[model samples]
Target: MQFTQLKVLAVSGSLRKSSLNRLSLESMKLLTPTGVEFLIYDKLDQLPFFNPDLKNNPTIEVLNWRKSLKQANLVIFARPEYAHGITGVIKNALNWIVSSGELLGKPISLPNLSPRASIAHAQLSEILSVMGGDILESCSPNASLITPYVIPCDTAKNLCDIAVINHRIRELWNRIETAMITK
Candidate 1:
């Protein structure tokens, strides 16, 4: 079998240390297919809200984050539902990239870690579409949690429901690889 290398950048909508969304990203890293590499963004909290008024010069952090996204072959967003929609932090981070058009036409995946993963999936799809992104697919694990805490190691066996989430992630990577090679 032949596989292509893909560099994927993953961003979580949650900033809390024990966020299930962040844990979902970790699970993705552990489950990535061969020839694929995943990088998780750990500083979403450091990003300032998008400001069109500060147009003359962009901050180093913002510029660097945008650069990373531009260099990535695929973008994955693991997010949670906040009051029936995506979190403000994730929305704000995306706003910063909207003007650069870095995500335009980029392949994206939105995976949810909440009990209401469907809500998160729909909300993120709308947000990404408005920003001009191409969403490859969205998946939600059956191991959704009602609370914000991380599932204990033993109980966490299903936290990511590896079978389902990994399959979707693999599919996305395959699509990304095909697009990269065909382009």
Candidate 2:
């Protein structure tokens, strides 16, 4: 049997340069099996606010964003909740893609790095549902207490949890079984 390689497009919802959400996505990339590749979309800050007025003629950045979605076999989002909601950049990206049929029937997963992510998770879930994204069940690492505020780079406790998440992905995503079978 032959299995096609899975291309996962991982988007970090946080815009800060030191976002733990981005770090988690990077870590996920490291943990994923050989047949799966996670492409971290680092251009959130480059996208402009979504304007329904401009849907007919989007900018080059918007065009590129849509192209990325179209090329991926799966989508992954790593986010830190802000004020009980998904970050602005991510929401904006979603808005831009709303008119285009990019997210329709797409399999999207989100890894929550904040214990306070309950509301944001539900909100994003509803949004993804409306956008027609198939949210993969129990696939995200929703294990964290780190706030969306400011966390230094030297936080060991959080790092330790993140380490476990790396292992969790393999177990939950069934990459281990897939790897064993492929071998």
User: Which RMSD values do the candidates have, in order?
Assistant: 4.5, 4.8
lDDT of 2 by residue, 2-106 (tens): 235777798988876557777666656656666666699989788888888899999999999999999987888877788988889889999998868898988
After TM-score superposition, the amount by which residue 171's alpha carbon in candidate 1 deviates from its true location, in angstroms, is 7.1
Q: Write the per-residue lDDT of candidate 1 for residues 1-183, one digit (tens) a residue.
A: 144667889998888766766766676676666777789987777778789886457777788788888988788887777777788888878878877888888877665545556776787888788878877653322334543223433222365565555555455455556655643
On a 0 to 100 scale, what is the lDDT of residue 103 in model 1? 85
Which 10 consecutive residues of model 1 have the lowest summed lDDT? 148-157
Candidate lDDT scores, in order, read 0.69, 0.72
State, as a TM-score between 0 and 1, how close model 1 is to the true structure: 0.76
